[model samples]
Each structure stands twice: as C-alpha cells, then as structure tokens.
Target: MGLDWAYFRRPYEELHDRHDAAERQEYLVGRQPTAAAHLAELAPLRKREPIPASGYTGDDERLWQIMKLYALSRVSDYLIELFCPAGDPPPGFGVTGGRAVMEGSTTHRLELGGWQINATPGWIGSRRLELDELAAYTGFFTDIGLTPFEHAETFSPFHHEIFAVMQDPSATRVILEEVLWPGFWFGDLLFSRAGVRVRAPRHLIDAAVATTSTLYFTFSREPRPTSDLSHNWGSNSQWRTSFHRFYSDEDGLHLNWDGQVDIGEDPPQQPADQSDDPNPLDQRRELLLHRCFVRSALPRDEDDRFPYDDRLSLTTAEWPLRPESIVRVPWTR
Candidate 1:
C-alpha cells in the first residue's frame, strides 16, 4: 500500500469550517479578526485525532516524516521572504533555477532564467580589483532586477565595510565576531532552529575563510509531489494534501561555495573517503537558511494597510550586516 499525505496553507477559517463548523461559527460570532487569532482558536482541532489513526502504518509514518520535514523547510523559506530586503526576488537572484560555473579562480559564470551574471571575485588580496568587481557584480544584479538595497545610498556602507574587512589580516576573525556570530544569535532567537544554537560561529567562519574560493547562492522552489500514492492515504488526508503546486510562495534558497585550501599550510585532514562526505559543507547552507529565515521574520512596525513595504530598509540597524544577511554574498578569491 502506498502512503498518502496532504497539507494546505489555507486560512484557519477555511480549515475550521471543513473540520468543525460549529466551533468556527462560535469564533466568527465573537468578531475576532486576523488569521492568527483564528489559528489559535483551531489549535485544538489538531489533537482531536490522528488523521489516519493513533497507530499508523509504516507507509503512513514515512509520509508523515516527509510532510513534517517539508513543512519546516517551507517555514524557513517563508521567514526568508519576510526578512530579506529583496522582496519576492526575480527569477535570477538565486530564485527559480540557476547554475554557477567557475571559469577561473577569480571568475564565475551564473546562468538563470535565460540571463547570465558574470562575477569576478572581488576580495582576493587585491583592493582595486575587488572594488571594481564588486561594482560590476552590483550592476549586474541591478540590471537583472535583484537590487540589494531599497535606497542606493545604503550600498555605500556595506561596500566600505566589505572592502575594509577584506584588507585586514584579521578579517576572518572580525567577520566572525562582528558579523556571523551576531547574525546567527539573532537568527536562533527568531526561528527556533535548535541545530544552529549549538554550533560555534568562530569555527564555521574559520572553515569558510580558510580557503580561497568563490561562493554561489542558489534558490529554487521545491517541486510538488505528483504521485497518486502521496494523495490518498489517510482518513483526513484531504486536509494534509497541498493543493498548491509549490512548497512555498518563494523558492528554497541554497548556498554553495567552492575553493581550495593548502593542505600543507592548514591543519591535517581526514582520509579522502571521509573528506568526500558533503554533510559538513551542506550544513553551512542550512545555517545560512536559518540566518535568513530569522532575519526575514523580524517584526516591522509599519502601516497595516500596506503590509509589504518594498522601501523597507534592511541596514545594519534593522538587520546585522553579516556575510549571510543577504540573499547572495558571493566572495571571490
């Protein structure tokens, strides 16, 4: 037997009507406003019974796990959209789908949505070259409609800081202490991602900066499940099914970087087989997801009528200017 599961991102009012009309009517009569309020009212519905049963089949359990994981990932993406300044980014800017190819140590070619962004690493021990390349990449992103700031002036401080830090020999430590550490702390408080809480930011930063590399950030929407088996398994499977074609309103963001470190100059390494495992490196991307999600979820005091303020500024005050703060921070060596 195939396991089936469904999930919906519907309003609490809709869900309540389908599952328990009486209770929904009572809440509606009270004149409660806001989806959050309705959701709180319907919280009890979830505990009434397991969709299938308290004791689930093996297949049911497997599907449940997949759904839960997917849900958390969706939540993560939602938070990113909420906090990241680049609201509802274009098909490029790491959204949709893209590929990054390293043409040389300092140059990379990014292709997405029939557009291309050629990025030359900006901070590879050459101040002039780095600044020029940063300007070039900024223009490239702006042309593609992924402008990093609401106001062009906001870019000045960021550019200065990046250049200043890169020139200093203690750049790695400064970035960890001032940027990554604080950003991660702020993120942990918002997203409730326990995994990020236990790790040391110093170690993570050290690893990333240890090598001369080019980083590529990519975001893509998770494909919706199409199998019939995934659609028909539970008593309340209809409630679990996601009618929407996409996992999130936005794409799933992924961070990838490539570089080479001097084996002799750095600490001893594990054997080739052990070193080939991608989990440790992949965790870096997960850490970034947590950071962006929490930042995007940060509350803003703005006009209720205009919920989305594209002019909303994401500066050092609003969001810590960390390496992982933006949707994409491609550093070249």
Candidate 2:
C-alpha cells in the first residue's frame, strides 16, 4: 500500500521551478557513448582555469593537472557506472511499509530494515539526479583545479560516505549528522568520499543501518537496476580507467586507491565468522560496514566487495563492550 512513486518521473536535472544543469549534461551524453566520447575530451579543459590563475607554471604544469584529473576520472567512472549500479536493489526498491522513522529537517529521510533509506542524490525521483547533476557538470572538482569538498564536522571513514546511522545508545561520539554528497581532491588523491549521516555508538553499531534504496557510489534516486565494469570496457577503453580514489592522510584511511582498498589506521576487528574474512578485507570490517548502514558484504572487488554480505546483517552479536561508554570509535582499530 505504498505508492507515491516519488512523483512519477522528475530528474532530468529538475524542471518545475527550473534547475536544468544542461539537462543533466545532456543526459550523460545520451547514456554513455564511450563515456560520452571521453567526456568530449574535457571540452578544452572545461573552459580552462582549474588552476592556472598565475599558478602552476612548472612541475610539468602541475603534472598536467594530475593527468587531467586522471582523464576526468574516466568520465567520473563511466558516470557512476552509468548511474549507480553496484548491488542490492529490487526486492522492493523503495517499499514504504513505513516505520523506519525520521522524515524532515535533518533531511536524511532515512530509515532501514523497514526499508525507506535514502541519502539524497535524486531521492528516488531522477536516478540520483545524475549524481547531483554530475557534480554540477564536473565543476565541483573546480573545473580541474580540484578541491570540491563537503564536510559534516566529524565521522571520518577517511572523509565520510556513511549515509545514515542514527542510533544514540547515549551518543557519546561518531555524530556527523549530514552531508549528502561532495568529495574531491586529486592531489592526495581521495577523489571521492563525502556522503554522510551518522549518530552511532551502540556497542559499535549493527542495529541502526541506512542507505541502499539504490545507492552505491552515486546516482539512483529512481532508475534502479544499474551495472558497471564500464559495461565491459573497450568502448574506447572505458574512457581510460583509473579514478576510484578514497585515500586519506595524517596517515590512514585509504579505502581503495588501487592498492586495492583497505589501508587503515582504524576499523579492523569484528570477525566472529563474518564469513571468515579474506582476500584483503580489512580497515576494521570496512569501517564497521560503513558504521552499520549495511548494503553488506562487498570487498569481493568489482572494485570492492566481500568484507561481508547478506545484503544486510549485524546486531548485538554476543555483546561485551563499553569502552568507558565509547567517546570514540574514530573508525575503530
């Protein structure tokens, strides 16, 4: 008995009140014409000025703008696998049996298990608004100078990306609150991360999870069944690969920078047969499975998966914690 259908069909970069980011960048070049012809060879470096405002005269032109943001991050990874298609969706996409709670204000809309989860990106209306108008038609990366960020105070899985947690257990720490999307770097190379919403601290979470109303990396507020592998590449070598960064610093949290995920400075414990962990799945159960917002078991690597998966699972598990009532879990360790 849940049928609003997020208003039939919305995201073509929004209309009604007018927002068209060039029709979501021409609907990603009419849906991936070889990553939209190498994202049209960066259209004259997105009309120049990513950094040359009298800067970077040498060092090979700042290593040629980090190799043109690693070839425009392979058209932002084939435009988020042609619009967020990784895993878990369709067992009732946004089935609103209600109950998952929290409606407005914090803007999370969030809910899980009872299944209503979302972290904004098109909110089930326009396929995650094509990664928020393809990150504002790729300007967020600052046209290539790189820096585009978005913070939420604290909850570092090496630059957020949790999506929702909300379980107080007295809330001693791990309280970010919100930040739907925005991550960029290219220098330290953490190309993407920001997508938060947390509260956490219930003997280390497994009860309050969030997200998966069709979300994985980015895009999918509607238009479910997504897929990647650059749809099998070779169509111009999938626009030129390399650009799934998640690195961090001060010495840790490199979620996957081609060393193939799991670098860590924390988050690497829980293994009571969470499928006997294997094949490089650490960083503390992948930051306690994104601090328990389960879309579980991923690190099997299609980029990353298999740290554990049952689509979702975690709870109480033989409880025996209370580190001075956790004022910290800075992503475990």
Candidate 3:
C-alpha cells in the first residue's frame, strides 16, 4: 500500500471523492476502462508469470520485479492524470514519502525529469491524506469477482503489509497497532496484503529498520529495476493478475486459499503442484489476482531479513513467512 499505492499529491477535490457514494454507484461514475484493448496488452504478461511454480524459490525474485512494475504503472497513472500530464516516468522510477504522523499530514517526494518535486498538499478535509481516491476504485476487481480486504484484528505478516511497526521490548508477539491501508482477496487468493502498523518485539521486528522509509511493495522491499505497464497496457488488466491464497487459523497456515491450488500440504517452501508450468493454478480460476498483490509477505534472502531473526526460527508457527513469496501465518487473517 505504501509505494505500490503511492499518495495522490493533489487535493481531494481533484479526485471525484467517492467515500459518500454507494459502491455500485461509484463504479458507475468512475473511469470507464476499456477491457478489449487492455486485456490484449496484459495477455503477454502471463508469459512471464512465475507463481505456484516458483512460489518459494529463487525465481520468486523475478516475480517481485513484475509486481513492482505493475504497481509503478498504476501509481503513475494517478500521478500523470492528476499532476504532470506532460510527465513520463522512466523505467527505474520509484518514490520516497509517506505520512508525517507528528504533523498529522502527508507528503511526497517525486524525482522525475532531472528535478525533485517535494509536494506537501492539503487533503481537502479527507481523513486519509496519503491515500489517492483511485485506491478506492475497486470496480475492476470486484466486478471481476475479486474482493478488497482491509481490516484485521491481529497482526500477521501474511495478511498485513508491514507499513510501520512498533518496538515493544517486553512484547511476546505481534500486536495489531494500526491499519494503514486495505489489502485485497479473490475468493481465497490474496490479491494484496492489507497495509497496517504492527507492534512486535524488537528482537523479532526491529523498529528503526522496519520504519525506515524506502519502497514497501517494491521488489524484495529494496531497489530493483522493473517495467511500467501503463506504457503498454491500460490500468484495467494489471488489476487482474494471480496470487496464492493462503489462510491462517488457530491451527497453523493453510496454503492455496484454504486449499485452492492444493500444494499437497501446507508450508509451501517447495511447490507441491506437480501440474504443468506457467499456470498450474490460474488456468483453473475465474478471476486472476493481480501480480502486484503478489509482492510476497514472507522474508526473502537479504531482503527485509532483519525483521526476522533466530527468535523467529524458534517461533515458526507464529508467522509462516519467507519475505518475498506468498503464504499465511497464525495471526491476522
């Protein structure tokens, strides 16, 4: 939700604010995205998709690259539509800015065309100044059978994206600190992990490290080169991709959307679907969870591995994680 859904810096008036409108009515009034042209553009993306087959492997990095590419393109659509019409974000474009809670406001730092534009704009009386109105435009997702999920009672790396964290030295486990932004679900497929602030032990989740702003949804939460989808496909099809639906309960982790793809058993460190490559899963689904949502909630090699330490190894049952792939834990659902 952080970088993937970057702040729409303009005033709320710039967005036809739909908070007061009904969900159905909002869809009726929002941008009428053309599907024929957009789908044609996204059809080629599947040729590079590596999920279910590369769920917990090295190729997962390539998957993250694709996800960031999708997010950047979507966020760029809002930026170009609202701010700089003449602007075109290059291939390596990334943003750095978020809520300044101390000031009770939000700001953005956009580097483009050899200049840095730091914008601290007013939210036009909206409660969430950081969120662009487009974040709420879920018509494409819902209309196609995908569900948008945001609220969670507890904290789980699988269900919530680590936007911000609190260090409690005496804390035994993660506590639900705050909800930053909503995530999405497609029946059992986790489209996007909900953005939330989590309270955890400093030993398990470092405060300074986790709070340090970079790009939250980018490849492995670190800098990496990715493509822009808007330059090719419209925003419509990118909203429909694929993700592994994993669920957590009092028992433990349940991979593949409570057994959607059925990776034989749980703890998908190795893919169990011995089916065909490229699809093994999506071919059997009615809706495709956007690859952007596949940003991977687990910790990966040299990527956000600091939040997890030997303490986590001792408590693997607490949160089944790997950092860059898809999975669930026994906490937030």
Candidate 4:
C-alpha cells in the first residue's frame, strides 16, 4: 500500500502550525535563545512560499507556518546530532557472531539418488536430513548520540526522555548551549572527511516534521559469542575521533565540538567486507541519521557524502525506499 498523500498533507500542515506557535510563544516569553533564533530562520522552503494544502484557505497563516515547520522537522535528527554531544564510541560493541540450525523437519520427502537409487526404487529410510541453516552475527558499540531511530529527523525515540529532562527551561537552554552547538559542529567534522559540510538554520530545519511522525527501526539482535569480526569492532570510532578533535564532552571517552568543521579531501569508501555496507545499514534504519545531516549541512565537497536522508524520506518520494528489498539472490548454475 502507498501513503495516503492527500490525508497526510493536512496533518503535516497542522503539526507544523502548532510547533511554530509554541516556539513563537516561547520566544516572546523571553525563553528564546540565539540558538533557537538561528534555528528558526531556516523554516520556509527557500524559494517557494508554502502553498495551502488542498481544501484549506483564509487567514490561517498558522498553516503556512506549520507546513514550514513540518519540512524542518524532517531534518531534526541531523540538527540534534549536530548539536548533541557525540564521540568516544559507546561501550559494549564489536565482533559477535554465531550460527543456528533447525532441529525439526515438518515434511518428509524422498529424493532419488543418482542412477543406483532410481534402479532400487525404495525409500532410503525415513531418516532426518540436515539442510536448513541460518547464520547469526552481530556487532555492537555505542554510536554516541546517533539516532537509533530514523523516520523523521525531528522525531526521536528519546524525545520523551529529553523532554522530560527539559521540563525546566534552564535545562533546555543548557542543551541548546552545551549540547546542540558543539554536537552539531562535531558532526560536521566527522562527515567532512569526505568534503561535505551542511550548515543551515537549526530551527527551520527542525520544524519540518509531523509530531506523530517518528523514526522506527529494528535493531540487530545483540551480539552473540561465536566467531569474531574484530576489524569491524569499535563503535563509531571514526565519529569519536572527529568529536575529540573538537572538545571533550564529558571525561574519559566522550567528545564534543565547539565550532564548524573544516572539510578536506574525500575519503575512499572503506572495504565492504571490512565495515558493514553503510548504504544497506543506513537503509534498515531508514537512513534517518544520514539524511538529516545531509539536509541540514551544505555540501561543499565534490563528494556530498552519500545523501542518506534521501533514503529515509521515502513517504513522499517514489516507492521502495526500504533498501533491504534490493538485496540480491544468488543465481544457481
């Protein structure tokens, strides 16, 4: 089934309006900070004013405001990651693998053994045969603050947790000041290895999501004790290195960033067998992490770092946004 674009259109507008009004009220209440103001500036789609969703009209500027917010919300993950503290790979990850075998067979079938068995024409005997097998493998590591969920950028699985913590306005501000700016700056440094930098208004970028909209993904099963894939071990180590280059978020392993990243030369893709296929992994998570960053950052290098967001925002675009469907089946000789 396809998205009910017509139905979706209305809700999208409504959510955008509500979010904008709330933020505006906060701004007027002297609750707004420079970071928020910076974020708010980028709400509208650059060249076009919001066209009313079909069947709505009049003085509902709120609709326009919200529509803009909805658009921005789409990239919230990137903005949040950019702003939140990251770096220092998360604990407990790397090289877990295993295999499982089926113990039962539901049906019995007789196969003719070459010419000898055919001539005999008798059951080899109702014996169990081994065939079906599944291989299980897992790798673990903290991805820092990378969104485990990837659907809408502004949406997060931890939104409730963060909001609960931000019940106090002061706390929210701290997040903006300490977490947001530095986190964002560091994210730029990490990805810029491939010469990509995305700098945009954070609020405007955040407003683009529907509140009901959320990122959903199935996490891989926890790593098991089996064979080891150590090279693939280490969680977001490269990302951690980038973060440390800027600032240390806490102590020990964590890191943060204080400013914009310098984009240098493009880095070659790591060997596929070395690290998981970033594209496929990005897809299973709906590319929420990758996409939000791309949308928020301005790509300055020849390589724009694969636009993972394009993979996540599948609802509006053409069908088959889910990458796993593209997995190939081996041909039999």
Candidate 5:
C-alpha cells in the first residue's frame, strides 16, 4: 500500500505551526529544535505490521519480503526529501506504483523538478556531465538501501547488509561510494554509476562531518589496546593523529581514495556463465529490487542496521573500482 497521506498530513501541519511560531520568535525563544523533531515529524506514517508468514498454499516469503522492501524504499525516499537538502522532490523522481523498476533506471528529479544539471541555467557541459555521472550513483540510490542483483550476482545479500549500514550518515556515504557504487559500475558494466556528486547544503555536510568525527574518533574508539586487537588499535591510533580527523577520514571515504594503495589496475571481468547470467538489464532490476529490499527494512534498531553476513565477505570480486578512477576523486568530495 502507498503512504497514508491523509493520516500523515497533520503532523506536517503541527511542525509547520511550530516552525512558524519559532520563526516569529526570531528563531530564539524556544527549546532548540533537533533531528528528533524531524524524526517525529516523519515517523507516524510508516507501515508497522508484518505480512503473514503462512497465508496461502505455496506462499513463499519472497512476496512479503518484496513488500517490506517496497516500503523501505518509499520511506527512504521520503526521508531523503525530508532530511536531504532539496525539499519535496517532484513526483518524477519516483517510479510508477512507487517501485524501483530497473537496474539502471533513472528516477524523476523530484526535488530538483525540471531543474536538471543539464537543464539548469548557466551549467556548462562539463558540469552537466559531472552531475549526470554523480547522479548515476546518487540519484538512483540517494538515501535508499536497495542493491541490484543482476550486476553482481553476489550482491543480493551484500546489498541488504550495506543498506543496513546506510543508516549512519558517515557510513552511508562511505559504503555507497565504496561497496555499492563500485559494485554497480563494474558488476553491471554501467559507466556512470561510479561516483557520488553531493549537492548537499554546505552546512549540513559540515554538521554531519563534525558529528561524525566526534563519534568515530573520541566516542567509538577503544580507550586502551590489547595484543589481540593490536591492528584495530593501530588503526585508531593513526586515525586519532590526523588533522580534524573526522573530516579527513570522511573525505577519504567520500572520495574512496586512501592514497596508501596503488591505482591503475583494470577491474577483472567476470567470466560469462550461461546458467547464472541473466539479461544485463534484468541484472539492473535485480539491483534495484535489492535497494527496494533495504528501503523496506527501515526504522530498524541501530544495531540491526549493519547486518554483516559472513557469506558476503567470501570474495573480493564483489568489490570493484577502476584503478584510474580511484586516483582521481570527485572534485566536490
């Protein structure tokens, strides 16, 4: 079922009422607003029930799984609209029946409504190309957690796991460019799905970076090192010494470049297997549905967000990045 817009509309009104009141106070008199307010504004409309595990004869759980995924995708899109810079993306940014249709399918630019990079006034061809390239990664999966199956036959499970990690902003962007985008590009052989173009308001990115740095460095780090965990401690030690460590760490992640590693190697091509290989576009659909899967699994407890299955780490081929591209990071990052 689609969003219960009527049911969800009142909270928006309440938020606006509060916002207007706050504005009249010169944004000063009341308790400082927080993301909690934003979360509460968005929380009421989501589906909270489960599909019957045993409903009909031969009813596989996949249908319920698909429904859950659909819900997550819808919610993620809604959240992005709410939290991400652009407000209320146009209907065009979404797919028909509120579904993610195909692997390489492009969404209507809802937030940017007819304000495409190519169409934006004063945008040069290079800028347009960059946006297109960036969108190849971000627009398709912005704040969404689904993974495509066709591109990487191995992706079905891994994508679900990554979607879980995306709940954390720092981890979200990091995983998108690292684990997800590269997989989409080399696995699906799609050229544009290789990088992220963040058009985020500078302040939000800055705030996120600030929040993340403190969390990762001071809070998440271990207080002392043990011999068994020496590697982790060493890494944390390296991380602690960096300038504005969080920004540097996140910048490296956003760019997907560590510079410690060498670049210039070609992605190894997957050998065609007739039995397992499906149509390339179908693979893209698999990928999109995987994203839908993640979207449907939202509002999970923080611990549930990163379901790292051991099966996923079995192969390095599941991750891919062009050697040359690795050396050249996105200018925006």
Candidate 6:
C-alpha cells in the first residue's frame, strides 16, 4: 500500500490550530513581541525585492516569503537577546555572560562586554558595523548572547517545536497562508537562505516510510539480515534528506527523498568458533535530512554537488489532502 495522507491529516491539523491559537494569545497578551515593528525598524537594511511568482513554475513565492520571514524572526530574536535582560534559562540550557544593559537617557545604547556602544550610530560607524555583523550571522551572534558554553544545551528548543508543528499539513497551510505569507507579503524584505519549504508533516511521513521500505527491500535479498553473508556486509551511516517542489496542476506537491547507503570497509575475519560474536566495527545507519529547499524549477549548476543519487520519489495526486504515490523510474548507469 502507498502512503496514507488521510490517516495523519486530522491530528496534524488539530495540533496546528492549537499552535496558532497559542502563538496569537502569546502575542496578544504581550508575552511575545510583535513581528511587524521589528521588520519595520530593520527595513532599510534589506538588499532584495520580493521574488514575484507568475505561475507555479515550481517557484513558490510564499515559500520564499516564509524563508525571509524566518530570517527576520531570527534577527528579532537576536535583538531581544542583545538589548533585553536575560530571562531564566530554559531547561537544560544555561546563561553565562551577564545580561545586556541599556544606557543613555536621551539616546539609549546597548552595553555588552561591560562596555557601552552607541546603539543607533550612523549607517557607517561602529554601531552599523555591529548591526551588519549581527544581521549577516544572526545564528552565531544569537548563540553568543545565549551562553558561553559550546554544548547545544545553551540554546532553547522553542523554535524547533514550532517548526515541527509547521511541517504538518494543516499547520503548513495555516503558517503559509496566515503567519508566514502575510509576514512576507506585507512586511519589509530581508535576506533568506532559499525560497523553498520542506518537512511538511505529510511529506516527512512519506520520506520516513519510503526510506524504511528501501532498507527493507535491500536487506531482504540474498544477504538477509539473519544470513551469514549479512555478517560480511557491513552497514554505514545513511544520509537522508527531503525537499518539496510545487506545481500549478492538481498534484501540487512533490516530496523528494535523497538517501546514501554507506557500504563500510570489510570487517576483520572472526575466529570460526566465535562466529556468533558481534563485530566491534559494525556500523549503524544514521539518517541526515538536508533542510534546504530551492526557489525554482530552473536548473541549478550546484545540483551536481549533492552527495547522494536520487533514490526515491513521491508526489501527491491532488493538492493538500490526497495520498501520494511512489514514482518508479528506471535506474541509469
């Protein structure tokens, strides 16, 4: 049987709605800062106009807008970290550096590293330089503001939770239509990594099932997992990445799965008496999802840079809620 979209759509939609209401309530009550004000303040720094979308052409304008909005949101987060007093650390995360201080009665300034610098100095001075540096590498600076520790424990997982929900179909639509698209369309432009969106909840489920099926079919051959030949066949980490391509037609979504099955070096010959012993160098398969999504169907020269070959492909027959079919194509040399 193929992928079942109906089975997962309901739960995903409910979770998405709950998330949206929670976010709205958070913003309304002043628990979360408004995105509009932040974007307006940083408007002058944007470098590009919004990429317009004519037909689908596999280039989704909304997806690009989502990326831009996400970037802006990160910048806003960094600014909060820079100027506001540090709040209580999230669970498993700790803060080391002292909280940021605001100075100057008439012209407020940001004080970090125990020294104060003019916050709104002219476009070409030290203040601009600081802002530029923060904008260019928002993630790095945000990490610095959070803690001096090198471990992942220093950062909060709140954004990740939101992202996980965003991948769901109901959540994806809500976010694309309500939250992200609005921010992208009406808000000031900013920098973004790419114009693609991946990990839509349904797409993710498809990728996982396809990957598992591939592994199962591959293992069920002459060299079965329970067979002695399986002993000689060592497995290495599996790299799995997914991306989405949009279409104007009925099949509006294409979820692509690229996976690499690493075949490790031959294991050392075991003593015939100890054949049942486990190989110390036995490798485990690890899956890595490359989160990047492209902006258009136009051929990119960098596509050749992908380390894995196209192993599995799946696409929906209808937009939004239909089940997806696994596309089978003949292998090429």
lDDT of each model, Cα atoms only?
0.24, 0.38, 0.35, 0.21, 0.23, 0.24
- Which residue pairs collide, candidate 6? 167-201, 238-286
Stretches of model 1 off by over 4 angstroms after superposition? 1-5, 8-66, 85-119, 122-168, 171-333
Question: Pairing residues by index, what is the TM-score of model 2?
Answer: 0.25
lDDT of 1 at 276: 33
In the range 1-333, model 5's lDDT, one tens digit per residue, is 332323222332333353332242332213223312332333222221222333213354333332222222232222222222212223322110111112332443221212232221110111011222323334333222223332333332222222112123333222222232332221111111221222122222221121111111111111111111112445323222211100112223211111121112122122243122222322222122222122221121211111110001011222222122222223211
| Model 4, residue 26: C-alpha shift (Å) | 9.5
Kindly indicate the candidate among 4 and 5 with the higher lDDT: 5
User: What is candidate 1's local distance difference test score?
Assistant: 0.24
Q: What TM-score number comes out for model 6?
A: 0.19
The predicted structure with the larger TM-score, 1 or 4, is 1
lDDT of 6 by residue, 1-333 (tens): 222212212222232243333342332234113333433343322322212323123354334333333343333333322322223322322111121123334466533223565653211101101222233233332222211122122111101111111235543321221111101112112122111112434433221221111121111211101111122332321111011111112322112211221112133333344332231221111111122111111112211122232122224221222223434322222
Candidate 3 — what's its lDDT? 0.35
Q: Please give the distance, in angstroms, between residue 157's alpha carbon in candidate 6 and its true position after superposition.
A: 20
lDDT of 4 at 42: 30
The RMSD (Cα, Å) of candidate 6 is 24.3
Global local distance difference test of model 4: 0.21
Best by TM-score: 3
TM-score of 5: 0.20
The residue ranges of model 3 lying beyond 4 angstroms of the native Cα positions read: 1-129, 132-144, 212-317, 320-333
What TM-score does each of the candidates earn? 0.25, 0.25, 0.39, 0.17, 0.20, 0.19
List ranges where model 6 is wrong by over 4 Å: 1-310, 316-323
lDDT of 1 at 125: 23
